[model samples]
Target chain A: MARVYNWQLGREMSYWYPESRPKKQFAAVFDTNKCIACQTCTLACKTTWTSGKGQEYMLFNNVETKPYGSYPLAYDVKLLNMIEAGKWSGKTYEGQTIFESAPAGERVMGWRPEQVDYSYPNTGEDDCSGQVDHGALMQLPHMNWFFYLARICNHCTYPACLASCPRGSIYKRPEDGIVLVDQGRCRGYQECVRGCPYKKVFFNPMTGTSEKCIACFPKIEQGLQPQCFVNCIGKIRMAGFLNTPDKARADNPLDYLVHIKKVALPLFPQYGLEPNVYYIPPVHVPASFNRQLFGPGADAAVETYKSARKDMDLAGLLCLFGCSESLMTRWKRTGDIVVGMDDSGTQLVRVPISEPVHVRTSFDPVQKLVRINCP
Target chain B: MRRRKLIVLPALVVLLFVAGCKKAPVQTTEVIAVAAAQLPSSPTDAAWDNVPEYLAKLIPQDLVEPRLAQASTPEVRVQAITNGTDVAFRLRWLDSEQNDTAKPGSFVDACAVQVPTKLMPNPPAPQMGEAGGGVQIVYWRADWQAWVNGREDNIKSIYPNAEVTHYPFQAQSLEKGSPEQKEMAKRYAPADAVGNRRQSPRQSPVESLLAEGPGTLASNPAVAVKGSGVRTQDGWAVMMVRPLPEGLAPKKRTSVAFAVWQGSNKEGGARKMRSGWAPLAVEEKKP
Candidate 1:
């Protein structure tokens, strides 16, 4: 008799889920509608974590103004433009992802929050107060067309940072799904830096370790919101425990996850990292713009967005997981997918709502975008 | 009258002593010693304390001063080492003031070299080479080299030296041992003087040929005979030594080479060999 060897033996074995996966994750949901572009979050993260000598320009949490906006300097457009202009191609190896390849001698944009330095050198002053040069432009846009997206760590599902770490230093908590990199074990390969689509990971050259948001585990452990969330003047961000399949969560794969009249949406699902951060699609954008940002046939995008929002059905597809072609088709055909209600009952999202809520339509002084609008 | 005065004086003295009676005496405890020998002999003995020196000089300047800590003689400069392994080492530092302090928080804003493990005389280590086997050199060619003619070519950029040539096939045979070896093996009979005559007078053994006996054989020879495929070559024996370094990670597919003791009966088994394994560097294109 031929001996049938079991491939899944030892580490090749069964699923090993740790006990009481500490829901130690610290998460933040920035209500993009409420961001004022005041850069308070950027400053808070800066003064708290990135104030060290090399971190003069480092911003842990930043507010990026999209569609003509950026993080002070707006690296998104520049990077996106490069990527779109066929100047950049993602790294690939033997049909596998090896590392990100940039053109030889291509200049990596440094973190420049402003065009000019604002702080006086060697002053040791906590606040940034400097004499302005007339030649320098301060808030120079003749017309402000960008919307603010105040971002921190998503504490994503299947976090790219955790997966790309070669040293096995990065780990995601089973309970709360909070991903973290162990400072002691990191060899500073910067794989996480290259793999992270959002470019959230920062390399501390001194420690030679990649550092990002810890998700404020202490705050989460105490059952309070994170500092950024609490301090956010717009009050759009929400922190919650994303449920797993074993433990049924408030949202379901089908009903809420699929687009219904009311639902939430995901950002860049094609990145395929399974982000935990869910969004209520910015309403009122043009159909083509929505299709390009979300995907083609977003009437289906609306349906899937609804399934993500609503807590009702799990035809076994959660936004946490990619959906089947059938589900996508159903969503496309019937734009009535219902997403679940948020922590607060104020905003009700659905697939194919009467209309889209465009961020450019109106702006609030405190919250950069208006949350509630008539379709 | 004098006697009466004395008795009164004596009685007065006793009464005064009684009036001055005090409470219990307070005891002072002796100081306990942890051991006088435990103190570091000199300040320089504490060299390993600076953990920050492990980082290279390329570290951005802003991170330097804040993390630099100083200590006394045997001045320890600790730095985080993010090399093949994430281990910290102590080194020297130069401070802005240029004054050397041995206490904690004293250091220079510079980098240091890796400590060589080979220098320590009585350093903590396990036994090298097992009881039966020690250092031995075996020659069976197992190197990939570009051949010129039918002989092993010494390619400068590819190989180490003129003497060090790589054979396309994995193993080779060593001939006429070194002067040191010839002297050590004086007791053994020479190939020509031996009773076993497997070849004619014109044919010489691989050892004799390598020993300047004849230079007619091919440059790269195959050690393995046809039909028998053996991955582990026992002929290329080595004197197994100490265990690998604690920090060295072992890959599943690794190559090992060594020297072994040679014997007449067992033709190819080597003795007293030094075995080592090196990581094969595979080049990859950056993404």
Candidate 2:
């Protein structure tokens, strides 16, 4: 076994392969507050890939209502319950991960889902916690709260799918940290499906093989964002390459949201895979509930996002979201506007720190004159 | 140190036994030639009642098993006879539980007989074969038999409460030659495309497969073999029949291997109970 540092967990973890970092890791941050549960991202991913036979049930990108909904039903909840039952604790999770919890001869701890478990992809949709009275007025802290969570393959540093493949068919690309399953080498064992806690890997019964999101490597190679990232109707997603934790730059939008401002946090950091996708927690929900979904940083992240207007750098970085097709490697505050630059130092997008507004004109019927109205 | 040596010695012997050692005891059978009129057509034929039985020991595939465990069906009885046209072999193994269905996360009971295509200096690797070794296998699956016999149930039959109002592919108005219809048809079994409708009775459940090496197993489209299996109170009685391929002289000494899968144990792929190559001597007819 070899040990590698997981920045999300803030500790070292064991992996079967030697420590080898990718040149640049595919990363993204989703602002959950801005999502409207439109599912355009899901459709974009479905039409681009996973439209073949046996992939009818696969949704590479799914927007699910948190505290209620999940694609494979209670996939995350079941695994999270297992971890909690196993007494997972500590800031760095001193307890066993799924890899370390395997039985004597097994390579990983996994459970094969029943066929019935996959019958329904969207169960308990939009079911929120708490009830509301007929005449009660709602305030900042509402009685019932739910948020849409847009999820895609995290392309983790330590992937469970890569570890559980006995035939060594699954591999992580060194160029961009994209995990992929080699179709020729795979024998349709479905071990990766069983081992993945997020349940992202899907088995193609027609071809008798397993497949998952490729991170749109074909598009990424040409400096284009993935379909899910570019086609998001909510404009809540930002895709970019994340630097290693030790080498993170403050100018990078991903780094600014995830590290410097610390307004975005990884989901289930206790899983110990160091997932690349980060989330800005919804502010309306209770801190404990947010903490259960995201890690201990959820409370702090929500607080930072609530006060983002006062932080000019944070406000400037937020302007870069949904800006361009090419990933922004650097950004700067120029006067009252933020300029996003690609790796070649080409300005891809320019947005003001605060968007400009225009007043509407009201028509006066009797005088047949237009009157300008201001807020 | 002396006590540790004694403990290690027995384990080494067991390991060698499981490793397909030639010194391990093997049941040898002599194939007798019978008149075409007197040859038995089925495994339960009365003619097979008088044949000599050879007992072969089946060992667990420790190389791929989840743990190093003993074989569930340790011993199997075998007998063989041949007519001028075809050769038939009967394999009887003890498995009290009948596992004949395949579900998600579950496997079906199966058995296979492997013979090399050509003579070699050393027999091919018992785990399929090495490249260029050219191993031909006759595989029998219980689930396939159930499917052919109309005893297998579809998804709706398994989950009765599932609400499936309509399937778009089943629509009659859709043009059969349209691309949308063709794409929808891919969801059905490959047999459906060729008009071999499901739940139809067939002559045999066994399929002919060939492998040049591990992970190279493929179904032989030639349809050169046929077999059937019957489940009894004690175990399964399976009989496989095929034409004796060229290259093997009638009286020459050759060998064949046997593998059995107990579905209840979740055995498939490389995880199975198998016997090392056993000597097979076909006797010539008397003038």
Candidate 3:
């Protein structure tokens, strides 16, 4: 008979375990199908939180087309290409999420959008007391379809940001799970900036601190939604709790992470950060494309993905989950997202596999939704 | 039976009294560390008194440097310079002659400057020793402009001598990265470790000042000073100032900051002032 260890009831187990961290993990689900790229969410966040000095060029929230779309220039392609070209291998330390191995002075490369070649358009200078030729002629080429993707810090279950911070400046709150950058303690290593796969953590020269989306915990504490979630014009976003692993891994967090798609598919699961944010792949984009982007196990991963994406598609998932809904909608309506969902098909949920959630011998999995089986 | 009943009653009474005493209210301070110290009741005339004296020896007050041309308002002007796919722009004054090379695009764009100024005592003597010198700030407008290249942008403000003396910004504003955008250039910035991109210029000046330490109200009329600098046991800070410069608009409120020195060294203090500069919005009180 399987022993049921009740933590709340204070049942003693044979094994001794340290107290769990106060901060819990969270997940976001996005439905790409309902997305209508208006960029209202983008403006809401930028104007409200990031509209400060150094943030002028930063879109803490941005929408991008798949295939060729990316903010800060071809961010995905650059990273993907490096991995594919064997120039970079996702980091692994004793199979645990240590830090990405350094490539002899090669910091993780980033794309500066300003370096790209494109056209600019004139935004009429109606308010410049006198005529200031303040407009750009740059215009993106129109295409058959596009989808938007909003992005922000994933606040992952096993956040790469937490692992990468050398000074331990970044911490996830035990009470609410919101990741925070302690301004006074941060030495500004910028390692977290490079270590984070999402590239959400940014450096600020003004305060000499690293700043990111706070998930508006101040509001969350009051049972209020985050600024982005509340202001999402499409109403495609939601704030909710995420499930944590009951058992401890001997070596790797990613090992347990990618497999969750059998039940919580992460966006670009192949990248292997074990991100908490999940998405339902868009409709127009072929399932094959998802397989390629997510990996050969994409179908097998659908269950995990579906649990995360019960409501939203990839673009929608990214938008609703983070602080970038406005950009997601904008990119969705525009041809910016090269790898967007196709306009056909109604595949919303992934086929569920009756896999039992595993629990550690010392602890039992508490049910919020999925059934947990403790060993 | 009567004696037994009397014993039980006294025991119950003592027990009840002990329980009541255990339920005492927790003691807590009503005032937060921040609220305890108030802003200076009057303007600081000390910092201002030395401005004229310093400017007199540094450069001719009447010296017509085109770069120092005064704008009617204190607002810093903006302009966009380039427009192609690989967009790049220059920042300069609004009324000043356009730099074929530089232009201000948006009020929300970021910019950098390397000024050699520091916090000074009354008579404006440089105090806090020279730490790393020359800090860069990214400037931006509160309003949104399309993320594009070659967009001419301008913002309005109402402050005195607000025109940018360094017309034609040699470096790109915060919209783009800076040359010293790495950690190795520590001497130029004391706090910058996350590179310059993280600095949000949109933060209100008051919030930024409050993040620093504790200060008391300065009551010296000679300086119209409203606050005194206070050091804490652990060295965190909070400060406030009042009676800002006359002739300044409401937007130009003053926020004071102090840099403490390990020891008082006359020559060291003078050198520190020549090297370091604090982000200031404070104005001098008139004599």
- The model with the greatest lDDT is 2
* Deviating ranges (above 4 Å) for candidate 1: A1-28, A71-144, A244-262, A294-375, B1-287
CAPRI band of model 1?
incorrect
Tell me the lDDT of model 1 at B101: 12
Q: Model 3: runs farther than 4 Å from truth?
A: A1-23, A85-101, A104-145, A245-264, A295-297, A300-375, B1-287
The Cα local distance difference test for each model comes to: 0.33, 0.72, 0.36
TM-scores for all candidates? Answer: 0.37, 0.73, 0.39
Rank by lDDT, highest first: 2, 3, 1
B184-234, model 1: which lDDT tens digit per residue?
222121121223221122111121101111111112122211110011222
Each candidate's DockQ score against the native complex?
A: 0.01, 0.11, 0.06
- Tell me what TM-score chain B of candidate 3 gets against the true chain B: 0.19
lDDT of 3 by residue, B164-256 (tens): 332122234422245443322332222333233222222221211111100111112232211221122422111223232232222232111
Q: What is the lDDT of residue A229 in candidate 2?
A: 86
TM-score of 3: 0.39
Q: Tens digit of lDDT per residue, candidate 1, span A88-143?
A: 12211111111122222111211211212222211222112234445333434323
